[model samples]
Target: MNTTEIFLIAILVIFSAPYLVWRLGRTDYWAPLVVVQILCGILLGPGVLGAFAPAVYDHVFAPPVIAALNGIAWWAVMLFVWVAGIELDLHQAWANRRETGITAGLALGIPLTFGALAAAFLLRWPGWSGPNARDWQAVLGIGMACAVTALPILILLMEKLAILREPLGQRILRYASADDIAIWGVLALILLDWDRIGRQLGFLIAFGVAAVLVRMMMRRLGKADRWYVGIIWLALCGFGADWSGLHYMVGAFLSGAILDAEWFELEAMDAFRSVILLVAMPVFFLSTGLKTSWEGGGPAVFAAAALLLLASVGGKLAGVHLAGRILKWPRRETHVIGWLLQTKALIMIIFANILLDKGIITSATFTALLLMAVASTMLTTPIVAPMLRRLGGA
Candidate 1:
C-alpha cells in the first residue's frame, strides 16, 4: 500500500481496536476507554505485536506511516498538556492552602521517597539506568514518575463517577492542581543542563517578559481571538523550550498555565479537551507504544513494573492515611482519596517519555514505567467505588 493508505490503516487500527474492546468488553468501571487505548498501544508495540508478527507490524507501521503518526501525536499531546495547564486552579488551592498543602505534600512526598528507593535498587543492576544519566538524575526522574498524578485523567474519572461537581471532587482537584505545578517545576530541575545553562536561563528570562505581554494581549482580545492566539503562543513556547534543551512539553504546559482558564467558556474548554482525546491522543498513545521495548527481557520488565506499582500504590495510600489522621478525615475517606490520587496515566507517561527522550532512563525502564502506569490507572475506579459507597458517597 501507498504511504497514505498505510497511514490510514494505522489510524484505523489505533482508533478502532481499543474502542471495540473498551466498548464491547464494558471495561469502563476498571478500565476507561483511555486506559484501554494505552494498554492497546503497548500490545501493538514492537515488543509485543512485532515479536509475534514482524511482517504485519512492519508493513502497517512503515517509516512514513510512523512519521505521519508521530507528527499528529506530537501536536495532540502538546494540546492535551496545554489544556491540562489551563485547567489548573491554583486560586482555589490558595484559598484552601492549609488542607491542600498537607494533602498534596504528603501524597507527593511519600511516593517520591518510595520510588527513589526503588530506583536506587534498580541502579544496582544493569539495563535500568540510561547511558547519559547520572545516578541522581535516574533516581529523581523515576521518583517524580511515581509521584505524578494525571490531573486530566483524574477529572475524567471523577466525571465518570458523577462526583465532579461535588465538594470532595473540588477538594481533590485542588490537591492535584498544587501537585501539578510541582511536577513541572521538578521536571525543569531534572532537565537542567549545566552545559546549556546560559541558554536555559536566557529562555526563562525571556519567557517571563513575554508572559507579561502575552497576558496583557490576551486580556484585550475577544474570546475567539484569544483561542487563535493561544495556539500560536503554545507553538512558540514549545519551540523555545526545545531549543533550550528543557523539552517542548514543558513549554506547552507553561504556555497555558500562565493564561486564565476563565478566559475561555467552560463548556467549550471541556468539549475541546474531549475532542482532542477522542481524535488526536490515540496517535500519541500509539507512538508511545512504538517506543516500548523489553530489552532487559519481558519477565524482568514485568517484575520491575510490579515492584514500582507496589511502591506507587502503597506509598500513596500510606501518605493519605497519614493526612487523614492529621486532618481527622472520616473513616473511609483516605482510602477513597488515595486510590483516586494514585490514578497515574497520561501525566506519568508523559513524564517517563521525557526521561526516555533525555536518555535518563532506558527503553526497558520506560516499558516498566509504562506497565506500572497502566496498572495503577486500572486499579483506581474499582478500588475507589466501593470505598466511596461505604464512606457515605463521593
Candidate 2:
C-alpha cells in the first residue's frame, strides 16, 4: 500500500483496537477507554509489534508513516496542553490559600522526594538518564514525573464519575490546579540551558509583551474570531518557545495560561477539549509507545516501574493523610483525594517526553516511567469509585 493508504490503516487500527477492548471487554471499572488506548499503543508499538511481527509493524509504521503520525501527535498534545492551561483556576486555590498550600505542598513534595530517591537508586546502574543529562537533571526529571498529576485526565475521570461540577470535584481541581502550575514551573527549571539563557530570557520578555497585546485582541474579538486567533497565537508561541530552547509545549501552555478561561464560553471550551481528545490524541499515545525501548531489559524496566509506582502511590497517600491530620479534614476523604491526585498518565507522559527529548532520561527509563504512569492511572477509578460511594456519593 502507499504511504497515504497505510497511514489511514494505522489510524484505523489506533482507534479500533482500544475501543474494542474497552467497550467489549467492559473494562470501564478498572481501565477506562483512555487507559485502554494507551495500553494498546504500547502493545502496538515497535517494542511489542515490531519485535513479534516485524513485517506487519514495518509495513504499517514505516519511517514516513511514523513521521506523519508524529506531526499529528505534536500538534495534538500542544492543543491539549493549551486547553489544560486555560482550565487552570488558580484563583480558587488562592482564595483557600492555607488549605490549598498545605495540601498541594505535601501532595507534591513527598512524592518528589520518594521519586528522586528512586531515581538516585536507578542511577547506581546505567542506561537510565539521557545522554545529555546531568545527574541532578535526571534525578529531578524522574522525580517530577512521579509527582505529576494529569489535571486534564483528572477532569475527565471526575466528569465520568459525575462529580465534575460538584463542590468536592472543584476542591480536587483547586489542588490539582496549584500542582499544575508547579509542574510547568519545574519543567521550565529543568529545561534551562545555561548556554541559551539569553535566548530563553528573550523569549520570556517578548512573550510578556506579546501576551498583553494578545489579551487585548481576544477581548475585542467575537467568539469565532477569538478561537481562530487563539490557534494562531498557539502556533506562534509554540514556534517561539522551540526557537528559544524551552520546547514548544511550554509555549503552548503559556499561550493558554495567559488567556482567561472566561474569555471563551464554558461549554465551547469543554467541547473543544473533547474534540481534540476524540480526534487527535490517540496518535500521541501511539507515538509515545513507539519510543518505548527495552535495551536495558524488560524485567529491569518493569521493576523500575514498580518501584516508581510504589513511591508515587505510597508517598501521595502518606502526604495527603498528614495534610488531613494537620488541617483536620474529614479522615475518610483523605483516601479519596489522595487516590484522585495520584492519577498520572497524560501529563506524566508529556513530562517524560520532554526528558527523553532532552536526553535527560534514556528510552529504557522512559519505558519504565510510561509503565508506571499507565498503572497509576488504571488504579485511580477502581480505588476512588468505592471510596466515593462509601463517602455517600461521587
Number of the top-ranking candidate, with lDDT as the measure = 1
- Per-residue CA lDDT of model 1 for 173-266, tens digit only, reads 9999999999999999999999999999999999999999999999999999999999999999999999999999999999999999999999
Clashing pairs in 2: 130-359, 130-360, 130-361
The alpha-carbon lDDT assigned to residue 58 of candidate 1 equals 96
- Cα lDDT listed for each candidate: 0.94, 0.93
Alpha-carbon deviation at 88 in model 2, angstroms: 0.2
Cα error, candidate 2, residue 293 (Å):
0.8
Which regions of candidate 1 are displaced past 4 Å? none
Model 2 TM-score relative to the real fold: 0.98
Candidate 2 minimal-lDDT segment of 10 residues: 385-394
